[model samples]
Target: MFGYRGLTISDDGILEISGVRCDYLVEKYGTPLYVFNEEEILNRIKEIKENHIVKYGGVAAYASKAFLTKYMCRLIKREGLWLDVVSGGELYTAKSVDFPMENIIFHGNNKTYEELEMAVDFGVGRVVIDNFDEIDILEDILLKKKRSIDVQIRITPGIDGHTHDFIKTGQVDSKFGFPMHDESALHAVKRILNSPALKLKGIHAHIGSQLHQNNIYKLEVEVLAKFISSIKNLFDYEIEEINCGGGFGIYYTEGDKRLSISYFTDVIHKAVEECFSRYNLRKPTVFIEPGRWIVGEAGITLYRVGSIKDIRGIRKYVSVDGGMTDNIRTALYSAKYTAVPANKLNNKDEEQVTICGKCCESGDILIKDIKLPKLERGDIIAVLSTGAYNFSMASNYNRIPRPAVVMVNRGQDVLIVKRETYEDIIKNDL
Candidate 1:
């Protein structure tokens, strides 16, 4: 089973991911914690490559924005996955770990002049061009260096990804990419073809994130293929590279067919190959940047039950020490997640209850109606399918310090990210 959703509690009343126990982790690391299974993340990379890329010749670019630490960057490199970094900090994280610079792709809609220069100066594998303004910046630097920067055009293919509205990037009305139908985008592509500072390697489009349907992805490929056909004469594009953005979904619970990356990739390969063959286009090196599917289920947020309050006849509230501060996907995107009692997993499930965070807002409910086991103070609850966005989006609201992160592997554990201290908190205070 994919390690993302396969967690079980031992007979000793200890919850474990794969073979790594959670009860001992909570005892040693304290509640309000994060635990990631190293094996799961690595397996996902292999699955993505074997199932999708081997057939399609696609490059699996691990989106480093999800939960980046030097250890994570190192892991991504060890697994032979390319990196997709959006900022100087993310690039720095990958660089410090000595991730292959030739395998790194820099992306951002509004990369600063300094950032753009640094990316080119670092000789990143590619810079995903998002807008006309970015072209100006790249030209300024690449011209000064008199070296063409390999790049991909981020285009909006007008296909809906059907995920949360906030995270959707493929829509024409979005700010992330250049509109595919626009003359401006075509002009930018033309300029890239004519320029000495920039090389137009391929076209890129991301339909959405946390996607559920594979058909939507097929539709996106069709659109991109048709457009590529249209521009073949003007730009003479031979389809050397084509990046279908990553938004492949994974199951948060039962019946959520976040189809396997392997399965999805094969289907994508067929789609792209068929389209390219039909249109007489040369085969291109396929590329996909997946952040969530690679790491989401591999992570779990461990929280300690602080109090259980029964609002007489209204509802019961199981409060945890950390809430929106650590996992804001529930509050910010109404993202659904599943939780199980770390020490009480086998107990009969009861009626629904709102799992509330210790945050100040009433909207900080982690799960609106989770039928979890009967709980008590000091109980540890592990929130699953949180590896992607939780820690990367953690906030310091109400001035509470963030939780620590630990990675478990082969029954051995190590503290990957240290807990933030109070003094560390005020260190930035002027």
Candidate 2:
């Protein structure tokens, strides 16, 4: 099973997503292509909006760091959801499409002065201030521009999420937010409440990415609620919002436990309510910034098998046209994924092989020791659940041009991102 709602296997043993044949898309878009199911994406968006945001009266912001294109920004805006941008480039991408400025929230620990000025200029809804220097920078900018902006102070609640160390941002030792153990978070709050140019709205925290445990968010809400209650009592200020950064897990491999958006919403709502009731505080408006949950399963990457080298009693190396340049998760976080041969979806002729990228690096592996049908040259391979970070993190490693991206719905395909040309790789060269 593909573990996604949009996938289908044809009787002729080929793969189809949203009724569009994968082979047909490969023929038109070329190999190493990223295909997104628009219907599925919309469905996921509706799922979150109806089940999570509307149900609980919260704001859902799509984390643009996952896989943001101008079209994606438009899609999020069309759905009436907010957009989260961590850099000036992402902010500009959304602005280029005339997305609503008030629906954007700027986030980053070390936001540059230019990015802060841009956020201030655009009149973004909120800025999640991360550190002391950034507070100073934003205060100065707001004073000079004669603008007052709403902001939430990002706090480290000292809760360790069960995810990759690289992504665990809520721990006391993490570099992301002010730690609650010491006076740093408290000090930041005091400074923000005292600032004339910044309106201290609430607090924010992101535990980590790719999480499966339901209690993780419950724990996060507990820590955040306690901190918020104490701060509110200390400063006699109303906490109007609670921005819980999203990192909900998705199905990439069989090991992943499939959880629904409704389940995540239910647990978080209960936790937030219980914590608020315990602390004798009002339930502030909640905001969740989900990047991978809504888009991960809606995307699949198609790569062409180039060469197969079988070593006696050792391994079979099946190299594809793309590797770390397009998907570096395996090399970066040992992220696991499930892939199938698009041309032989139901084939029972299994063979053990390691799917590798064409990159020169030895660690540029895509999948390891997977049992699939005998793969041949030109066989189309579909790597599922790549919609989140694949294209967003792609690079020009080894000078391999990144692949094109297409969105499919109702048997219709539209190119969303053009395939990088050979010249595009060296365009910045002197």
- Pick the lDDT winner: 2
Give candidate 2's whole-model lDDT: 0.91
Residue 258, candidate 2: how far off, in angstroms? 1.7
On a 0 to 1 TM-score scale, where does candidate 2 land against the true structure? 0.98
> For each candidate, what is the lDDT?
0.85, 0.91
TM-score of each: 0.96, 0.98
Q: In candidate 1, what residue range of length 10 has the lowest lDDT sum?
A: 1-10
lDDT of 2 by residue, 81-162 (tens): 9999999999999999999989999999899999999999999999999999999999999999888999999998888889
Residue-level lDDT of model 1, residues 1-430, one tens digit each, is 3234557668877788868888888889887999998878877888887876675567889988888999999888888889999999899888888888999999898899999888887889999999988998899898889877789998888887788899898888989878976676788788788887888888888898988788887888888787778778666766578898888898787658767886667767788889988888877788989999989988999998988889888899999999999999988898998888888867886767789999889998998778877898988888888899898989889888988999887788899989988887889999
What's the CA error at residue 375 for candidate 1, in Å? Answer: 0.9
Alpha-carbon RMSD to native, per candidate: 1.7, 0.9
TM-score attained by model 1: 0.96
